[model samples]
Target: MVSRVELFALIRRDARVEGLSVRALADRHGVHRRTVRQALGSAVPPPRKTPARSSPVTGPLREAMDEILRADLDAPRKQRHTAHRIWERLVDEHDAEIAYRTVSKYVARRRPEILLEARNRAGVMDGFVPQTHLPGQDAEVDFAEVWVNVGGVDTKCFLFTLRMSFSGKAIHRVYSSQGQEAFFAGHVAAFTELGGVPAGEIRYDNLSSAVRRVCFGRSRVETEKWVLFKSAYGVTSFYCMPGKEGAHEKGGVEGEGGRFRRRWFVPVPKIADISGLAGINDRLAAADHAEDARHIDQRTATIGQDFALEAPLLAALPVDEFDIALTTTPRVDRYARITVRQALYSVPARLIGQTVRAKLDAEELVVLHGSAEVARHPRLTTKGGQHLVLDHYLEVLAGKPGALRGATALVHARQKGWFTATHDAFWAAARAKHGDQAGTRLLIEVLLLHRRMAHAHVIAGIRVTLEAGSVSPDVVAIEARKHAAAAGSTAGDVEVEPPGPQRSRSKVVSLPERRRDSDLPPDSRPAPSVAAYDQLLSNTPKKGNAS
Candidate 1:
């Protein structure tokens, strides 16, 4: 089908080329004579005119609608009248008949004009100015929620993004939570990745991790730790205005988080544990580096090229790194556990009833006895959560074997895969041969072997003893040492000490040996000639006959 403009072109062309009369042109084009005359008058088609239509129902209600919309200027923005509400009011209060669609079309056209008039009267200006950032001068920081499959379970994670404003270069880190420690850890990680901090102020929202209180105007009450951290790094913080009003102040990072999540976390990354985040973060760093070669928006240079100009301008890192871990001294209870941030973490059993130093960081808790590290566990996210290490209670278990069965540390070990099925099998066999108490004690002795030997070696030793129908921990220790020695040398035989006096002296049966003939490679040489030896014997036999 031809458009109006096309139809007009066709009409004018036919009249010009064919020399057809206006009546014939109209008949050929299937149009009116007036249309052909108009086409002949001008090459362009005239705009279609819409005739004014009278609305008897809404004509009188216009005044009422205007009054309602005008009254909305003083009302709260959310509570103001809508088009439908205005129509309903007209129907209920004035007994006026008006279509909702008519009211809606009128309101849509008139409301913007009312707002413009009001803004002009109030002398208010609403517009955005183009922003320019100097190299390494400005950056934005923000946190966004990311979902990941951890241990086959969907888990919520917090993603921290720090983007350079000038180059659009960004560094990101993921955490279990957005707490103060995690916030500090993110900054540390980003700084390490970027190789320096921004010389100018970094923009941020009113996150509690940095600001203790959001004060009037731009003044903010910063947390004590945040102040110290800034001093350590020589950083300047620029807090954006509260809520959506300040969102545009740091638009770079606000958009970067979404882009990164969509780019990398689209499949909902799966990790066996929180430690898997290190691998994810490594991949993200590579991705960041790869992006440096790509352009951002209409920029002439690639991001990496721009970053090269900015990288050198950044402030140098401090000579001494800041220790971001929170230090606390907690007394160990009778259970040999220290409570830190409302979470229970096991230390050595000997530390019970004693005070120990605990350092809590974003990802882990380290317990210290004097200058030496005694215990370490992954940080707990929830209140009243407990992390127990089985080795911490080994000494206690040795004294009271009954406690091994019901020990919370043992349960935790099983959950963590630290305790294997081989251990359980050996324990059951030992308990059957020796009584429960003696067998459990023997298992505790074997468990102690892990401290001196590798875990796999100890497990192999247990298997060797169990196969030989021996329930002795000493035999397991001897076999475990043999495994350790065998691992050290592959081409030579391993020497193992004999079992202790308490163990049975019976020689353990061994597998059938290989044949000697089969052990040697095939020899291609013929049988050695004995002709020379025969000649010597004949020469000596004549002397024997004379004698």
Candidate 2:
């Protein structure tokens, strides 16, 4: 069957080529004279248009639907009304007889018009402009929440990403917290890893780690620590406009985090502890290097190739490193612990009731008495968490031996693998041999060995003492020192003598045997002769009489 286009072509051809009249052409083509006239005017058929159809059922509820959609302009984006929701509202509130499809069709056509009207009234324009970035001049930094299975426990962590605008080269780091220290640390790590800092500016949202308060427009009151860090590194921070308006400003890093997470963190990387972040970051560094070979968007050069061109333009790292640790003076409690960031860390018992300085970074807390570091512990994530080192309370436990059985510090020590089965075995044996009170005191003395000796050496000492059927602390101390000395000895310290009746005695001569022969200079000196000395001796003998 001929379609309208084919029919039109036949009519037009008959009229033009054969010189048929419009009426005759229409009749021959079995069509109206108007159709022949239309074909004569244009070969192409006009597009069919849909006429406006009146909806009797939905027409009465138009005002209510418009009201709902109009209100949606001020509503939160996620909370705004949908077409189905509008239909539901109409049915429930006004008992209007309206099908969902009718309401959906109406909304699909009207919503954009309404939004455009609103935009015009508010005098706002919406459009995206193409961006061009200069090499080594601009970067974007942001922190994104990531889930990691660290130490067999699912933990929420923060991932810091700094992406260069021109090259698309990005540096990523995973941190336990998004604290100020972590913020500062992230920049330092990125600068060091990238071999230099962005020369122009690093863009950021109003993160609390950096910004204390958001002023009008792009102005921000930054935190003191952030200001100091930026100044020290000679960095210029570009704070984006507050809230959702600013999100697009750092879109490079914002999307980079998600892209990186999907590519690398798909399995929610398993790690041993917070300290294991180092390994994950090392993997990310390698991934960054691997990404250098790939091109971004329509760029001709690979990311790595672009970075190579940009690297030399970047600013050099600062000679003086900025301190990212938060320092505080907290008085040691009765438990011989200091409270930092609402977490407890045990210090020496002697420092109880005294204020000691504490320095906290992203991963660890260091407690100090004057210049001497008294204790160190991994930083805790949860509030009110206690990290007690059993060694810290040993001095107190020595006075009250019974408390050692039920001390919280002891429980934590066992959990941390600091108090092992060897220590427990030695404790039980000492109790069996010396009785409870005396045995406990002896165990404290043995525990004291850990303060001065390597932990493995102490454990070895305890094992040896138990195998020897002895519970004496002195015996364990002697065994521990012996293990320490044995571990400290090198193969070079052992005497290796050449095959001879008499051993070479000179330390200088021993060097040849100890060192590789190939490494030493050749023995090129001539053998000493006594012929000149013999004449001098004979002349001196004769001069003894003459003089």
Candidate 3:
């Protein structure tokens, strides 16, 4: 770790005074000859020529091993991990220099430790114990998997789970990753559902989120953050020992996750979107609590009934709910929504594309511009999902003369007899012609037409082609067009152009604004062009055909 500059100063002193050889200098310095030579080089060495430290996995073979691991980590195998097998694989597939014996040593050193594997627990007395607990005293937390639909796409999900030992009351939330923020948010949400933070020890299955160092036995050194959280709520957290053959120690909630999955997640919850998953899970956990369990140690009450009594021990909600999830500042997009977990969340149009802190939790995502709440939605569960709503960008749509989209609220703004029969076919055609983004935006603009017309007129015009009970954005636009012609305000409300002859493929030219260096202040970079455009439009007038 010694700096080369300091080493060079010593080398120069030795070279000037003692005239020591490079090897001698290296010996005196207790370093490599090459290092000593570099320090005392008469000619400067090119930075590119410097050699990095040596490791067992080096050069092409190391890269090959990395690629091999990445490519086949999930390959079907009983145990694809023995040193001989890995060595054979390398020789067969990648032409590696790796010896089978050396591979064994390497794998022994690098293989991640697995502590919890399923096995018989009948004879074991060291696993999770004291399952039947006094009401309001103990809770266990873990993670489980389920399937969910995001933006109409089905994907596997990771859910954090919490359960009360006495009442069998449980709660869980889904997240995209098992990172610190999600773990913290899970704790927050679980505690909230428990009605208060439990007063007794909080138990954990040796997850890295709560423990930093696993000791030799069933003990662990908690992380600074974990310690702080426990102290904040004054609950003792215990981590199960790593690699211990004890099942009973963490058996209660340890098996609960699998039980829940088998009972509930066999077929992933089929839903339209992630926004609906939170409510679904909330209801799902409630149903899970209705199960009946009768044990001698457990009181006469069922798990659900016992949990009801334990619920009272939880602390009351603080004046301000503690944001357990980590927060990073985010900016709104041209659509006036902040993207989190790949989903776009609608914030106020006034704050579109502006820098704001995003507090992410398992249950909900909150975007804030200073003290103002920009947007809130069920927290997303994927890295690349976009949560979009037209209303978040309404002001911006109203400002730009031809901004294609209107607010999401436009979906509801049909007037009576304003747009007439057979608009559905045209609307569907328009949407099909435009991309979803452009189509949704265009629909929002149609809804804005209701500003001048009565709601009944908007409905009437839209219903011309569809049933009276049915509503469509295209119908609203048709009604608005009729009223615009009669009022003479349509010409002024929007540009006189007639929507460019309704091209099948609506050409969207998104003008991205450049953020100069000046716009990037300390601790904050200039907002991206797309996000900025979203904000700019969100602040514009939304009542007219301006978008």
The candidate that wins on TM-score is 2
Against the unseen true structure, what C-alpha lDDT does each candidate score?
Answer: 0.86, 0.86, 0.61
Clashing pairs in 1: 292-304
lDDT of 3 by residue, 1-547 (tens): 7565676788879988999988888889898887777777643443555678676554456555554454444555565556676788788887777667776665565444221111122332323334347777777777776677765677777778777766666776666556667788777767765668777766777887777877877667777777767767667676655443444555677778787777766666666555576677676656554454533243676665666676777665554655466577878676666766566677767775578898876567777778877566666655565555444655566455244324243332222222333433435554686755565455456556545555554544554423323244654555445544444444334432333332331221223322334575454766556764787787788787666
Candidate 3 segments whose C-alpha is farther than 4 A from its true place? 1-136, 149-153, 166-196, 206-229, 243-248, 292-301, 304-320, 325-327, 332-353, 370-372, 391-445, 449-461, 464-547
Question: Which structure among the candidates has the greatest lDDT?
Answer: 1
- Local accuracy of candidate 1 as per-residue lDDT tens digits, 33-63: 9999999999899999999999787778777
What's the TM-score of every candidate structure? 0.75, 0.78, 0.49
Model 2 misplacement above 4 A: 1-40, 51-59, 76-92, 95-117, 123-125, 425-443, 464-475, 478-547
Residue 199 of model 2, lDDT score = 96
Q: lDDT: which is higher, 1 or 3?
A: 1
Model 1, global lDDT: 0.86
Predicted structure 2, TM vs. truth: 0.78
Q: Cα RMSD (Å) between model 3 and the true structure?
A: 29.3
State residue 100's C-alpha deviation in candidate 3, in Å. Answer: 21
Minimum summed lDDT over a 10-residue window in model 1 is located at: 489-498
